[model samples]
Target: MLRFFRWYCKPDLIEDIEGDLLANFHRTLRQEGPAKAKRKLAIQIILLFRPGIIRIFNLSGFQDHFKLIQHFVISWRRIKSNLTFSLINIGGLGVGMAIAMLIGLWVWDELSFNKSFTNYTELAQLYQNRTFDGQTGTYKIVPQPMSRD
Candidate 1:
């Protein structure tokens, strides 16, 4: 722990000073109650000259604020990628649904017509009738009689 502190506060006698403070703190805590011990610890911490706790704000001049731009760029890239992927997914689903609907409509029309026709099983088209002359004659023919079947 001492080596770690020494390395962390390079070129400074922070480790020695902290060790002395800790030793004095433990001695004081042994003589005082827990409440006074906590108060004394807080006072010591506030009085410690640790450079890590200091904040450097540029009040007199403009600050080099590039982090906000970097953050925005990253956020925009993520949004664009997500939007593109969603558009592709929605487009594929829409086209598939349209094709399915078209096929369904065609099948429904064919089946409805078949069902609406009267005597659908007996329906037939008449072919041309042969004649004695070389020319052929035609006539639309129906069933000879319903009883003939």
Candidate 2:
């Protein structure tokens, strides 16, 4: 509970607030016992999450606010400077990405072939040779087995 409070509390106020919380927790633990003390601790932590107590909201992309705008401005200027070159480069990137996606999907399909069957591990390709018009040719599957001693 204290760790949670520390995560969002302002740096300078964390030590002071944490000391106060620990002191209060000890008091409550002695008066009312552990369960009640825990509940009080959680309630106090929740109450302390207000605007003045909690640290700044630094969510994803928050730190990059100015950098993102600057990058957009620079990219816009570059694109506007050479419209034809920018369009060609963007088209090439699109085609390359599409080809990469297609190749990845194809490789996935080839690797997954025959894996859907329950007896795939026991399956094997059998080949045999036979004569047709005095010409012998080899082909898959054994229709019959011949044995001799």
Candidate 3:
């Protein structure tokens, strides 16, 4: 299998190489022992760089390889579908981040509003209820009231 992989530069040759390697490794293990088989397989893998060694398989062009073709087709399909989905995902994430940032800024601003005031310790909010269209609404007003100690 290693020989086949070293021979075929095409992507699809991976599966054939893997299968071949497994079959040869198992055969070697059965014929010899585990240690010898491992050593032999390792030697074969190492020797794969030798010229004219893997050329005996004579595999065709990369595009002719079924695995490469299948991968290309699948990738093309995903690219088409992912274009719109990816845009939506990015837009949603951007909007969500912006909203979160704005809320954080608002909270920070509100908290810091009275911090620099000279009468910060005496600051208080007064709550008043008003009726409009038969509905009651409550609002808080600054500089309104404080509790006596």
Question: Cα RMSD (Å) per model?
Answer: 17.7, 11.4, 14.4
Q: Which tens-of-lDDT digit does each residue in 36-135 have in candidate 3?
A: 8888787767665454433445456754797788998997788688998867878999999999999999999877767777777766546889899999
Q: Which residue pairs in candidate 1 collide?
A: none
Residue 18 error, candidate 2, Å: 13
Candidates in order, TM-scores: namely: 0.29, 0.44, 0.38
Q: Judge candidate 1 at residue 64 and give its lDDT.
A: 34
Over all chains combined, what TM-score does candidate 2 have?
0.44
**Model 2 spans > 4 angstroms off:** 1-63, 121-149
Which of candidates 2 and 3 is the stronger one according to lDDT? 2
lDDT of 1 by residue, 91-136 (tens): 9999999999999999887666545576666655556686766887
On TM-score, the leading prediction is 2
lDDT of 2: 0.89
lDDT of 2 by residue, 1-149 (tens): 88899898999999999999999999999999999999999999999998998888667686589789999999999999999999999999999999999999999986676787876665445778999999999997755434331
Query: C-alpha displacement of 6 in model 3, angstroms?
Result: 40
Give per-residue lDDT, candidate 2, residue 93. Answer: 100
Against the reference, the lDDT scores of all candidates come to: 0.67, 0.89, 0.72
| The candidate that achieves the highest lDDT relative to the unseen native structure | 2
Give candidate 3 regions above 4 Å deviation.
1-81, 135-138, 142-149
TM-score of 3: 0.38
The residue-level lDDT of candidate 2 at 107 comes to 94
